[model samples]
Target: MSKEQTLMKLSAILIAALLSITSVAAFSHSGGTDSKGCHRNHKTNDYHCH
Candidate 1:
C-alpha cells in the first residue's frame, strides 16, 4: 500500500526471479545424450547443441 512497502515487495520479487534463473543453470546438463534417432556423439548430428 505504502510507497516503501511497494518498493520492498518489488525488490524481493526481482531477487527471487533472478535466483530462480541462476538455479536453473546449476541443474542444466550441457552435454547431449544419444537417443534412439539421434547419435549426439556423431559429428553429423545437429539436432541439439551441447
Candidate 2:
C-alpha cells in the first residue's frame, strides 16, 4: 500500500476509536448518591465513589 493510503487508514481507525470511547460517557446511568458521594452500581452490585 502507498504511504498516503496507509496514513488515511490509520487516521480513520484513530477517529473511530476516539468516537467509541467518548460514546461510553453517554451510557452512564443517572442515580442518587449517598451522603458520602458514593452510589451503587446496579449492574455489578458494587458500590463506588465518583
Candidate 3:
C-alpha cells in the first residue's frame, strides 16, 4: 500500500481503539457506594446516599 494509505489505516485503527477504551472506562465501575449503601448515579456520575 502507499504511504498515505498506510497512514490512514493506522489512524483509523488508533481512533477506534481510543473510542473503545474511552467507552469502557466510562461504563466500567468499581462498585462504588455511599454511606447509606447507595450506588453511583448514571445521570450525574456521582455517588448518592439513600
Candidate 4:
C-alpha cells in the first residue's frame, strides 16, 4: 500500500473512534431515579424524593 493510502486508512479509523466516543458520551446518563419513587437531575446528579 502507498503512504497516502495508509494515512487515509488511519484517518478513517481515528474518525470512527472519535464518533463512537462522542455518541457514547452524548447518550450517557448521570443521574436518574432508582427502583423507589425518586428523581434526580442529570446536570446536578442529585437525588430527591418524588
Candidate 5:
C-alpha cells in the first residue's frame, strides 16, 4: 500500500484500540464495596480486593 494509506489504516487501528481500552478501564466496575474495600464482579461472580 502507499505510505499515506498505510499510515491512515494504522491510525484508525490505533484509535480504535485506545478507545476500547479506555472504555473498558473506565467502566470496569460500577458497584459499592464493603468496609474492607472489596467487591464482587457480578458478571463473573469473583471477589476482588482493592
Candidate 6:
C-alpha cells in the first residue's frame, strides 16, 4: 500500500480502538451494580444494574 493509504488506515484503526476503550472505561466507572450499568431504580433505593 502507499504511504498515505497506510497512514490513513492506521489512523482510522487507532481512532476506533481509542473510542472503544474510552467507552468501556466510561461504562465501567458508571457505578452500576452487577456490572450492567449505573442508574437509579424508582421501585427501591437501590442502584440499578441495567
Backbone clashes in each candidate structure, one number apiece?
A: 0, 0, 0, 0, 0, 0
**Which portions of model 4 miss their true places by more than 4 Å?**
28-50
Regions of model 6 farther than 4 Å from truth: 28-50
Per-residue accuracy of model 1 over 1-50 as CA lDDT, tens digit each: 99999999999999999999999877745444555433354566556543
Task: Give the local distance difference test score of model 4.
Answer: 0.80
Which tens-of-lDDT digit does each residue in 1-50 have in candidate 2?
A: 99999999999999999999999988856668899889987889999886
Give the local distance difference test score of model 1.
0.72
**Candidate 2, residue 28: CA error in Å?**
4.0
RMSD of 1: 6.8
Best by the TM-score measure: 2
TM-score of every model versus the real structure: 0.55, 0.57, 0.53, 0.54, 0.52, 0.51
Per-residue CA lDDT of candidate 5, range 1-30, in tens?
A: 999999999999999999999887665555
The superposed Cα distance between candidate 1 and the true structure at residue 32, in angstroms, equals 9.6
- State the C-alpha lDDT per candidate: 0.72, 0.90, 0.81, 0.80, 0.87, 0.74
Instruction: Report how far residue 34 has shifted in candidate 3, in Å.
Output: 15
Ranking the candidates on lDDT from highest down gives 2, 5, 3, 4, 6, 1
lDDT (10s digit) by residue, model 6, range 1-50: 99999999999999999999888766543344554556766579667554
Total residue pair clashes for candidate 1: 0
> What pairs collide in candidate 6?
none
TM-score head-to-head 3 vs 5, winner: 3
Each prediction's RMSD to truth = 6.8, 4.4, 6.1, 5.4, 4.6, 5.8
Give the number of the best model, judged by lDDT.
2
- lDDT (0-100) at residue 26 of candidate 4? 64
Error of 4 at 33 (Å): 8.1
